[model samples]
Target: MRHAGQRPADMPGAAGFRAAKWHTPIGTSRPSSRVLPSPARVRGPGPAARADRAQGPDRGASVTDLATMSLQQEIARDLQVSASFDAQEEIERRVAFLAGQLTSTGLRSLVLGISGGVDSLTAGRLCQLAVERVRAAGREAEFFAMRLPYGDQADEKDAQQALEFIRPDRVLTVDVKPASDAALQAALAGGTEFRDAHHQDFVHGNIKARQRMIAQYAVAGAHEGLVVGTDHAAEAVSGFFTKFGDGAADVVPLTGLTKRRVRAVAQALGAPSALVLKTPTADLETLNPGRPDEDALGVTYDDIDDFLEGKAVGEAAFEAIARRYRLTEHKRRPPIAP
Candidate 1:
């Protein structure tokens, strides 16, 4: 079967979704209100170097694959992608963690952006659950779900469904297209020019991502809440997030989860099965709207999950994913010191 990276959304996507970083909307930690967001490909090297991973000098296949496999296991340990865990236990652990943060910091609320995608949908619901626990302990806490759309989102109905399930204490909608356009114009008016429309769209998409975060932070500032990010192991592995855009947040609840594992938690929380398994995308590109993230990475989410779970994927997919982890290390780290 074709993976999410190669298949259209109307068709069934990959059997598994990797929790990718916020590159686009979906790769931004498998991303908000939705599935994984993708990163803009322009800022770094384009696609994976297919030629690099070819049979390692006639070495046995297992030996040739050792480095890649080792890296995968290293990351898996870091992210805690266990071979097994009860979904309910996962939910309880995460909720307690959120509540603990609230009690310790004295923050009264948790805020998240609802993308109507599985990532955001799941995160939003978790926020609601956490805050509810805090309140039950005689503390005053609340969860606010923001709808930061860029004029219109492709999966708005799905976003609404996520809201219905989350039932957050507050819902706010802010149209980001206006602010995003203004920023793009201001950047161009500085005598900067793009080589093409694709480049222009890439810049515009990143601007939109930052703008969405700005709105979320603003709302969080106003409400005395911490911004909750949807970051998880799958997205983190790919570094698919938009650095300081979807990547910046006060709290990230979904760390160490695979895409399917995130789905498992959402299912336990009673999210509709269909929504939990919706096609994952960053949908960040205006040039190719609603594009599957797999297309951008030149591999599928299944490839990512397989790699993360220590299962073998095709050489092409394996190399592409490993290359992303190496190239995007900067995205996952702090600035260099003097």
Candidate 2:
């Protein structure tokens, strides 16, 4: 099997979907109309029906209205219950602890791919804290933040923000356009027809992610440092990441936390409020206004994480996630022997 750092000849260009912060659609926590029964009366007529009609349509409608109200109330109650269980504090502590552990591993320095997303931001912060702890102990610790862009100006902007936040020993920017274009041309030459908008998006998005991963690993090797991954539990659970792409990391600081909790940890760590509040985007498309990742994946991160944690995933949702997860589980694991 090809190692995570190696880019295959047929690999497409760097144009993966951008990461964006999530905003739950309006009324997501509320009961939907599907929960309510139809207000229309039954057309069928019979003596038994007529006898049962003593309750009248008004009574039935009233009952349904009450039931609908109760359903909404119940949904609200459940949401509150779920909200109460957010693992923000726990995740933050874990990340902080992980940072200490990494330093104790006798590593000289830390390197990370700073994408300006919550995951990367959280990882960067933890690395900074870890370096500080190591410095306090009279040990040498360094942080390098690399900004790898694939012909995207927005990526430059995000990288700049990350640079300002982390203030690493050195900030490096590598342009992957040459490699990306080569792969894209190869894909076109192979006569791989782009079927629709979705297919095109998928192909392009995977290319960008894989390219970034390749660049990150190359830098890690040159610096003799571990490559930090920004993947979170939500993305991992739904297999939303590209294999050997963003999934390639020497150390994953936030893999155990959900997207929602990741945001909270970022906020708690004094990350820029804007960075915490901004919608997550992978910054793959510099020209086009980026779409939310969940929109592209057709499911919310909250639902994905819930299912991964052994909560109820409906039959349809369960099958969808299960298949994707099984296929992508390889991305989450170390390389196996043949």
Candidate 3:
């Protein structure tokens, strides 16, 4: 299954690939496969190496080459590791631990919003599995999956696919548009001087997210269930989620996992391929129609996952990620007290 020029560890050239000392310049063009290095292997030049590189062009070029090669190797290694996991074992352990957390709260059930997206689908499936384990142990547990669409989600079919797979104890559908509209109307009702520009799509999207949480908490209140969230390490790191909106949850089972890991978990849990492979979308604004999550992120999930997994990223990717992580620090923190 190795692609062209990609050798296995036991293959003839792989040893050289691993041990070979690259002597090319920093910006030398390499095959796509070898352009990035394993993060573990990317290390700073030792004192002697740095001294040698400073001596002359030949040594400096070679040092730069080694650094570049290390970066490429690190990235490739991260990618390889990302695709491999102990799916069943991980799933079982996560479910058991999450079930313990849920039961510890004395809640009768777990309620979560299912968008038919991979994150929610994976979290929902994990919750269902946890509830099943709870019941098997003769404890009372149930799962509530809510479908919250702003108006009409184009990807409702994906949600259906997820529901068919997860099959929670109860399914609830609530359109958050009315509340969203009411909030927007109330905000701009006074017709302030800046009313026109104040109510942007992102503003409305935040309202939708908060409204959805309201619906979720409403159901959780009646059923004595805790709200579960789908936020994972990837979104949590980048602060890609809305505050007090999708981010509000009693238990986040999928925390500390990157998006790539989430997908692997979904596949292990038998999520439908269509839902698993579907491009992730926020479904927030109607103006863009189908603005992808990556569009708002300013980077692809692949880059985010790689960066989050500690892979050595390119300069541009690193800067973009760092900027985002820095700016979104507020989103991940509690409000400042006077």
* lDDT tens readout by residue for model 1, 295-320: 55555677678778887666555555
Q: Ranking under TM-score, best-scoring first?
A: 1, 3, 2
Error of 1 at 294 (Å): 1.2
TM-score of 2: 0.65
Candidate 2: where is the Cα deviation over 4 Å?
Answer: 1-104, 155-158, 186-201, 283-289, 306-323, 326-338
lDDT of the structure predicted as candidate 1: 0.68
lDDT of candidate 2 over 1-338, digit per residue (tens):
00111111112222232221122111112212232232222112221111112221111111123433343233333222233444555554555665565565767667777777667777787777767767778887777777766676554565577567766676777777778778877888999677665455456656767777788778767766667767665665444555666655666666456677777877777778777766665445333335555544445555555554444434334333444333333333333347
By lDDT, the better pick of 2 and 3 is 3
Q: What is the lDDT of candidate 3?
A: 0.61
| lDDT for each candidate structure | 0.68, 0.53, 0.61
Q: After the best TM-score superposition of candidate 1, give how far the Cα of residue 31 lies from its true spot, in angstroms.
A: 20
Per-residue lDDT for 220-308 in model 3, tens only? 89988878877665665455565567766677677657788889899998888888888887767555556566655555677767666
Least lDDT summed over 10 consecutive residues: which range in candidate 3?
A: 1-10
Question: Which whole-number lDDT from 0 to 100 does residue 279 have in model 2?
Answer: 67
